[model samples]
Target: MAGDNVDGVSTRESLKSALKEIVDRTASVELSGYRDSAEMSGIPESSSKLAAQETSGISGQSDKELKPSPLSGTEMASTTATSSKSKSKSSTATTQQSITSRVETPSDADVRLSSAISGLQDYFRKPCFVHSRLDDAVDVSSVITAMSPDNFSHLSHSSLVRTATGVRELAKRIGQATIKVNLRSILIVTKARDNSLIRLTRELARWLILTRKVNVYVDAKLRLSKRFDADHLLDPSDHELDSCLRFWTPELTSMMPDLFDLVLTLGGDGTVLYTSWLFQHIVPPILAFSLGSLGFLTNFPFQDYEKTLNRVFDDGINVNLRMRFTCTIYKDGHQTETFEVINEIVIDRGPSPWISMLELYGNGHLLTVVQADGLILSTPTGSTAYSLSAGGSLVHPEIPAISVTPICPHTLSFRPMLLPDSMLLKVCVPRGARNTAWASFDGRHRVELRSNDYVTVTASQYPFPTVTASTMDYIESVSRTLKWNVREQQKPFSEDSDGSTTPVNDDEGADDDQLDDDWDIDDSAFFSSSSSSTALSGFNSAPQSAVTTGSSSPLHRDFLTLDGK
Candidate 1:
């Protein structure tokens, strides 16, 4: 307990100091950078970017505002910023006049700077939980409107450069403890024709209904199951438990996301995929259990169902907003269909003997002419699916990039490449191609791309969120399921048992003496003179932003040491 307190304080102070520095530097830069630009542009781009990107999760637009919640300290602070910002917007008409009337002074800037600093300090000081209440989503950028270049009200000089999907991540980054979320309704997805799983599903459903007092929904077909009715005594006539239970179908596509707070999967990865298929648009957060064949996506264990659900409804989940690709097919320049795929999309000559003569276009410019059997466009989540078998590198989910692996290329020099998620990829079945090619979304919904037809693939705003036990579970799955790099112990030799000569390492070279001198060189002794103190101090100073991110903070160090996701 004592050690944890010290570590928590260190993490908090480190994060606070780092964030303050960024705020200080950003305020200075944006004030000087956008002073003149604001005059020409009416309002600074930095200030409007936040409003522009506040698209709701249900709208399939922006990633912000994934959920809605109660009136709490965090939300209150955000609300204050937004309301004041709104009032500031109404007075923008006089911005030019105010700017032209007088020049900004150091004192004025200092006042604005203090306002920004104090606002952040107050918000940061609040305890994470107050009676198990929380803001809908984790949003670090909510209270960032205090620093203004002025003459413009309710305007920020620039926006934060963070792409995080939840406010919990921001809180975690800033050294906050686990907080709770409001979960009222849950929908459980189960595999078909599996009696054991159906029984497990019923068990979970009843618990959620009686113990949790939350509305529970199950597979639409289960309403007809005599076993299901007999278990709850709803088969004969009306019952009180029947009121708590509901049946879910794909027809609830438009309104299901808004009604259901969370989704639970009982079978396995396929059950998870079926959930994805059920909701092609805005998807609710999915918490999966490992009951299927391969448990890659199903990271949670069924044994811990009771504990996991309690924790989930009590303390919120740190959702990984996994990116999905929006693949839209266009024929003769007219949009025909659009489907989102969590895994990679394959475009190859289907059931034909001809090589797929496809042309690749990146962001509307011709990048290459594909002469391979097919091209694999995979998200990092799906990198291990079809991408790995097709020789694509295993990419981490955090990396904002896509895998482009050419499947069975005819050219000897063709190799797999990774493209940025921002790149708009268009693969066309050339009008003069010998035959039509096919495309599939997550190994389902096969669509034929005829001659002169092309499909545009880009990162979708709607990301699939799955509840994970911990980030390490992903790496552990690689070892446990895939058995990555598994091998038998190699033979060991002992000098006493077998007469042998010592072998030198292959890395050693003839110029070992020079390397030794370099390694043994002294720094403080060499820079002992007063004239070299500046250089010494400069050399000793390390950057705050490191490869692990926020290196100056103890929180980041702890994160790295724990192998955090």
Candidate 2:
């Protein structure tokens, strides 16, 4: 390895020397163009001839050194003709012709320059593509020259054209802006400690790296796991796997928000929730596989990962920005800890055998005194989760609303209420409260709220973007998992000749099938497209920083936006 490094250093040094020489020569040519153009503007024949002779000398030297000279044949001929014309006549026409020649053969000079660069590249046996990149970087002037003054903007070459009154016409032409990105790096969050999952991870990693040319990242634990890299799991000849595999820890994800293009979850909804946990600030678009049971969030089937991934990679995906709550716990009037809660935050009495007296305030105004067992503050995405079980409404994921459900209110009249996402609500354990309240963020991170300590809950700017199988995947999940509005099939009846109605006999297994088919139709009747239209356009995070205060950390700067525009 040391010898290899030494040889690499030598090659790089040689390449650098060659590049420096070319740069010096190009600089001399550019300088000659500017200085000679000014000098030959109105100078006599002898002066123009001197400039031409100097240019010819540079070209002649290039011809001897490199096969492809920087100056093309047309350039050389034009130089010679200009010199001859200058020697014969120092008239306005000759000067005009000389300037014209320079402009006319610029394209040829560029071609020759590229050809020369290519020839230089051939001399090196480097494995990387850096040599070819230097060709373009070194020839930046060529690009500026190509964009002539006449071409201000090329509408004909533009992707978006406003034909109709709306942007949909352009959307059809350009496709979804969210899906227009190059899906390069992917972080796969696999279910931990499962050999079968490990095998699937390896299989997916191989396909992503080899087939899609993507950088696959798994949890750091899988990098050297005995089961993950077991001999039986990998082929004996697959020595290249070690180098290709990549691992990402929680710390890295927190630091680098744009680390992954997309995150794939290989488990139930818990794994999907875990992904939300991984990136506290900015989260990439998540594509979850339903490997475990009760796949509310993980709708996509694991068996069809290839098809799903192909569609996501090639076409695009319909992403629903699930609303989240940014719960900030404040102790002694100073910010203690902040968490991005996907599901809900439970503020309940933990081990304390007393009623949890909590004060709820919205927008700095006292809303109510939660004289209950506890309060469940949840986003619309968590409505079907713990919030629903607590008698909260099953709000859709796209709804910009928060569910405030009392776990078990002291008063029977106290019911679950839906609040606008814009409301900045604060739940505080009163200093004179009976017992201290415990807070659980998304079913994890159990924290205690003491007297005078308050927790602020608001609609998070950073939302969890989950890829859906369809635009109505959330509805389908509700119907399938929660069995929403599901009931026994009504028997079909027909009027007889005697005016008596009788039940129509049908196959035993057919009623369930008919009812299943009817549910989709019934659902379409209730929920219209406008009702569930995405409030935010799509995922836009890690690009710009969010609203930051004095206490905000650098890692938590990016405020995830889903502006449809």
Q: After superposition, how far is residue 16 of candidate 1 from its true place, in Å?
A: 49
The regions of model 1 sitting more than 4 angstroms off are: 1-179, 230-241, 491-565
Clashing residue pairs, candidate 2?
537-564
Q: lDDT tens digits, residues 39-98, model 2?
A: 222223342333243334434453223222234445555666666776886787877776
Separately for all candidates shown, the number of backbone clashes (residues 3 or more apart, or on different chains) is 4, 1
Cα error, residue 221 of model 2, in Å, equals 1.1
> Which segments of candidate 2 are over 4 A away from where they belong?
1-178, 230-243, 505-565
- What is each predicted model's overall lDDT from 0 to 1? 0.64, 0.66
TM agreement with the true structure for every prediction: 0.58, 0.58
